[model samples]
Target: MMSVAPSELESPETRLAPDTPWVCLVWNDPINLMSYVTYVFMQYFGYSREKAESLMWDVHTKGRAVVNTGGREQMERDATAMHEYGLWATVQKDD
Candidate 1:
């Protein structure tokens, strides 16, 4: 077996690539009402009713919506917030 150098171990800072943006995605599901979805969007995101309704409609018709975009931690928080509101949500790195 070969000996490994201590430098080969990566720090947390080194593990993350710089400038990667993450997005929060809300998925369409049969359980939640469209109006409620819009309400949740407005409540959580502080979006105007019109904007929230638009996003809700997009998820209703298109099957998903990119609700928010930011750093990974922010996206994760948004996803968790959506879950708290009973919406199916996820986070992914923005391409």
Candidate 2:
């Protein structure tokens, strides 16, 4: 039997790495219309009409879409903005 000391388990691998990219995800909701979601993407992200439509469709069928990616603070801000726009949104670390 091998026994490990407690100190051996607390390695640098457990620390939170800096500059890790995060993502803002928009989830599908029953209240918001597809047109409104598309419009929000276009208006908020400045995406092209076709691009916004495509992302909106992705969210509709897939249940969620990665709308933005950056630092955790930026993702949080983006999720807040989506909330203000009446969309279901959340910030998460990118895998």
Candidate 3:
């Protein structure tokens, strides 16, 4: 194994600033039920029933919702978890 220096790594020009925010977007898809989506939101995020339901509604009506936000790594984890739960999700840098 070889050790690589951080300075040798290439960061893309579009890379986010050090503290730039990221978000996990949950998209409405035909497969998952609305009740299941809301339950996932509550289970994964620890959101209250009302909050989870509200976000679920936004996803259903808007076709998507910003389910969570934080550092890039956190958003990535959240998106992955959503996928594991059979939900459509993506992580993106907040604009």
Candidate 4:
């Protein structure tokens, strides 16, 4: 059998493309209230009340929600902001 090179074993992101859009995700936590999460989304992201509530519900029931999507740097910034608001957050390339 042929052997593969180290360079060939790239992550999905690297193999797909470098400019793939990234997303900031907020995870559910026991401490933060659902209303507070909804409020944060409305205030920080300027989402409509209904939209904010929907995302908050997603976090509550689904365990996580995509709070923002854009470039990697922007997604990182969004994740940091969520952290500042005391929400669990992380960034990853969009599938």
Choose the strongest candidate by lDDT.
4
Candidate 3 per-residue C-alpha lDDT over 9-93 given as tens digits, one digit per residue, 9 for 90 to 100: 5465435535688999999998899899999999999999999999999999999999998999999999999999999999998
Candidate 2 lDDT by residue in tens digits, 1-95: 79899789667776555567899999998899999999999999999999999999999999999999998898998999999999999999988
Instruction: Report, for every candidate in turn, its global Cα lDDT versus the true structure.
Output: 0.93, 0.92, 0.92, 0.94
TM for every model, in the order presented, reads 0.80, 0.80, 0.81, 0.81
Worst 10 residues of 1 by lDDT: 9-18
RMSD to native for every prediction? 8.8, 8.2, 7.8, 8.5
> Residue 64 deviation, candidate 2, in Å?
0.4
> Which has the higher lDDT value, candidate number 3 or candidate number 4?
4
User: lDDT of model 4 at residue 43?
Assistant: 96
Give model 4 RMSD, 1 decimal. 8.5
Clashing pairs in 3: none
Each candidate: how many clashes?
A: 0, 0, 0, 0
